[model samples]
Target: MPDPAGQPPPSSHTLWRAFVPRWAYMPLSGEGAARFGGRWNPVGQPTIYAARELSTAWAEYNQGFVQHPALIAQLRLDAARLVDLTDPAELDARRIDPSIHACEWRDAMDRGKVPETHRLRKRLMGEGADGVIYPSFMSPGGTCVALWRWNAPGALRLTVVDPDHRLPKTQASWV
Candidate 1:
């Protein structure tokens, strides 16, 4: 089953590849850096120093650097945003919110599905899994008429046949 954000569950590999290197969680495409020591250094230097300090402070506050619950929670949230899960789901028959589910879906997608060739697939995956993925028919002005496949016993399969040749839009709804 997919995570809330429609991704697979998190694993050590996912955590390391997606989170540890980016432990500082630096902002992208801006001349800004994380504030530390009441002064701002260049994006890289100051943030690195601040990260070290934060790690130390976190260790001091939590009595160890390993297994800090708050840091772990923050990392999980940040990782979810990074991988674009941000959806809720039922796992083992229990409901979970988007943030947690996104984390899971990301892990699954990273390890499981090969990237899709369809334009919409790129858009939906890029947008943090909020977009829907189902078969669709083409309409005038290049709109997709999607058909959702619900989980049911012996559900009837529906197919859409588009006579008009319309290009599928690759735009992501959520950035």
Candidate 2:
């Protein structure tokens, strides 16, 4: 993806992943963590594709989404973390179906195409370091997907944080 505001693209070697407790099913201890991921519940929750750079994650999460307090704290402290899923087999196992596409929200809204989906499958299929790292279709400063992989417990290391701790207000940046 082209750098939107003259900013450099993310480093080719590293990608970040963000988690929200409610959406991500991270178990305390078990193999099930390997299956941790979000679902595409259009009626319940709209499809969201995002990742990378703590600041970008911050902007995405703090965009007036009105998350639960506990979840907010959890995200602020630990849900967002760096990840490395360089193995092709590991990444393939968690790849989203090639047929499932994501919409470009802005374009759709501007053109009055409310529920239209763009060629997301095509974009995600494009090459990137380790996997696919692309700019977010929703947020300018955010990445939509990094590494193009998920649900690999052995590859992810979630940081544990105090659920009650609150992040400084300075971190909340709205789009």
Candidate 3:
């Protein structure tokens, strides 16, 4: 909510991500979404989707269905050039509707069509957005962020809360 007037996200904030155990070690990597695609990114685009709240991250990970093993991590998100979909003014300036958040991406992909959300994300990225913050679909009133790039010129910084180095050092643990 720091930039309702079309600026970056807060100077800093906390976000959460619940990752599958197989990919837990690489919590910051967007490879999963890159390979599988997501509501905000096309199959070849990388994205790290996280929640503004812990419970919302859990809900987003399970997607209102069966619960499974997960490695939830707290992330400290730093200054970001983001697009706030939660703000009507921002969306209006982009000529995007709020309904883009609830677009049925899977169904559109099933029909071999591009979902509007993906298109919107693509357009935003082209316009230099590091990510997008929007209302969560599974958790009402909660917010979520879908980050597309990091370590780039004018990109955001996202780090995991593993101060003790307890997590795996390499992805081989999952391999």
Candidate 4:
């Protein structure tokens, strides 16, 4: 997929295999943390099973953010016609406000489209590490995915998706 202006597209392996990195930075504002009940913490270190769930959740979230508008519109337009089929009571109960849903979807899409930038070298080093041993860093636009999963009855899983594949893997590895 092509990267949006001011946003980097995820690497193939990252898209298919690992957690996105931007998630690591979130609960960006205190509001986000409050939305999730409080300060967020990972349940455990990254693992293969957690990674798989992360990928699935991220895929679902991204698809929803991207397609919610169209899907909501189509569902609303068809709701009247579908009302008579099979369970009428069930259909009525399941009905959603098209306009409201559309608005929400649009808002989500807008938020998703916003770009995130990071100063890698500066972040890795200290704020005043100019001319230090660290290499020069370049700022780039990037997109990220956040996935939350239920690892067990009471355990939660969190993963971040880095579109640019900027995270370090095993020693001596490169993305």
Give the best candidate by TM-score: 3
Q: TM-score, each model?
A: 0.16, 0.32, 0.89, 0.18
Q: What order do you get sorting by TM-score, best first?
A: 3, 2, 4, 1
User: Which scores greater on TM-score, model 3 or model 4?
Assistant: 3
Compute the lDDT for candidate 3.
0.84
Q: Model 2: how far is 159 from its true place, Å? A: 11
lDDT (Cα, 0-100) at 74 in candidate 3 = 97
Q: lDDT tens digits, residues 66-162, model 1?
A: 6544322111111121121222323233242323212333334345543222233344345343223111111112111111111124432221122
- Native-to-model Cα distance after best TM-score fit, residue 131 in candidate 3, in Å: 0.9
Report the CA-based lDDT of candidate 1 relative to the real structure.
Answer: 0.25
Count backbone overlaps in model 1: 12
lDDT of each: 0.25, 0.35, 0.84, 0.23
Model 4 per-residue lDDT tens digits across residues 1-175? 1123311222222222222343333211222322322101112312121111333434433443552211100000100111111233322443422222113323343455311111221221132211111101111122222222223343332233445745444424422
Give lDDT: candidate 3, residue 75: 95
- Give the worst 10-residue stretch by lDDT in candidate 1: 12-21
Which scores better on lDDT, 3 or 4? 3
CA RMSD, predictions in order? 21.5, 12.4, 2.5, 20.9
lDDT of 3 by residue, 15-126 (tens): 9999898876788888899998888888988789999999999999999999988999999888777788899987887778777877999999888999998888777777
